[model samples]
Target: MEHDYYKEYYELERNHWWFVAREGILSNYIHRLIEQGKLSSKDLKILNVGCGPGRSSEYLSKFGKVTSIEYDEFCCEFASKKTGLEIINGSITELPFEDNSFDLVCAFDVVEHVEDDQLAVKELKRVTKKGAFVLITVPAFMDLWSHHDVINHHFKRYKIKEVNLLFDTINDGNKVFDTYFNSLLFLPIYFFRKVSNFLKLGQKRKGSGSDFEAFKPGVLNRILYKIMYFESSVINRKIRFPFGVSILYNWKKF
Candidate 1:
């Protein structure tokens, strides 16, 4: 992401509906797997790759022990202090863990920022045990590419087919167990991105505050959160959404 976006992330993730809903959805997915006997909390050893500031550790802690790995030292420091969890400052391209070390590995919105996404996925697979689950989320569609991607220094956004292919190759031929287009708020966000790109808004890329210039009101925020909550419920039921501003998936290691 952009240099100072961590501060923005810290704030937004704490209060933003987008972050809240996404985390809820991911939590639902994890617990669902647990319910199906696919994952056992007693034997769980989780690796949160690229876990920024460890904002997710609270929910993740419900499953089992959590180990956070971040490429940035600043983020590691912040996350460690905030979450009080084990935080490793390291790169995802080369995870400093043994083969099949983790029962679950989750990478949230991290791959798009990686230069070698394929290598990163391979590293993720290398660290996860056979039949373990890997949950991930990434920005979707090149058309949604705008100052957000630019400010965040994203290497690229992904389509459903593209991300699926990337994971399939690294997952030992195992297909993604469940994949869905997320962000039920996609239409509004799409239009916002289109307008921003068309008008060259924030194209020059300033500092950290550019992202919050358009923050919504409290009531609207709650309303959007509710909508996403319902959509996430739909996803929890295994109904794959056709499109969204982002993609979320769970893959089982073969």
Candidate 2:
């Protein structure tokens, strides 16, 4: 199946709660990276692979120029209109830019859908400047397979060590700086979904399906968002979890 189908699948889910939760987590991570001086406005030129709706690119643009590439044409149009950034319609394996052109490259929630994730990582490394970073996030735990995986066209969720190994194989001179999971509070939600599937409580789930609603702001919603923000601060620092809804990795070329 062409992975572009996965893009269309998620385009329908842009406003769901799952999407909101994802954005919140990404915002928190970027804020930390910016604060830590890992990124700066003085540095220009960034490449955002699988830059759905350009949400992260919008934030990244503040630091410099951002060029986002996405496989889904609909997503590219939506993101171009929404973020007003330079976005190209293309896949990660066939990036439109020249080599060693970007200061930072990001592929958020994108790798799992690729048929050969390691080859895609190699492409990411090829385009990034030496000493620059490639940031990525993907679903974790293959056993947590549910409707979301089927709908999203995820080949499989990742194990940190497995992903590390893949990155190592394709990294060339790059080294993984850190790796951790996100959405700790929502781990239970994933657990429930997985257990429900295992027990056959519902029909077999398929695709990148999520029940999360994004703009349904309420007191509980606000609280949950705050909790996630707090978690981002303490996670991978004070707390180390073996599993969660998503995994984040930051890799740097040496």
Across 171-244, the per-residue lDDT of candidate 1 in tens digits comes to 27475555555457788888987888788777554655344446654997888777876776787688888888
Query: What TM-score against the true fold does each predicted structure earn?
Result: 0.92, 0.80
lDDT of 2 by residue, 1-254 (tens): 23444454345435344555566656666666667776664766788898776666766677677887889887677667755777889988878778888888889888898998888888888898877778888888776787656655678898888778877884356554445554556566666776766765444324323434222556766665566556566652535556666787778887
Q: Return the top candidate by TM-score.
A: 1
- What TM-score does model 2 achieve against the real structure? 0.80
What value does the lDDT take at residue 19 in candidate 1? 77
Computed on alpha carbons, the lDDT of every model, listed in order, comes to 0.79, 0.69
- Candidate 1 wrongly placed segments (more than 4 Å): 170-173, 203-213
* lDDT score for candidate 2 against the true structure: 0.69
Off by over 4 Å in 2: 1-21, 34-36, 174-176, 195-209, 213-216, 235-240
Give candidate 1's whole-model lDDT.
Answer: 0.79
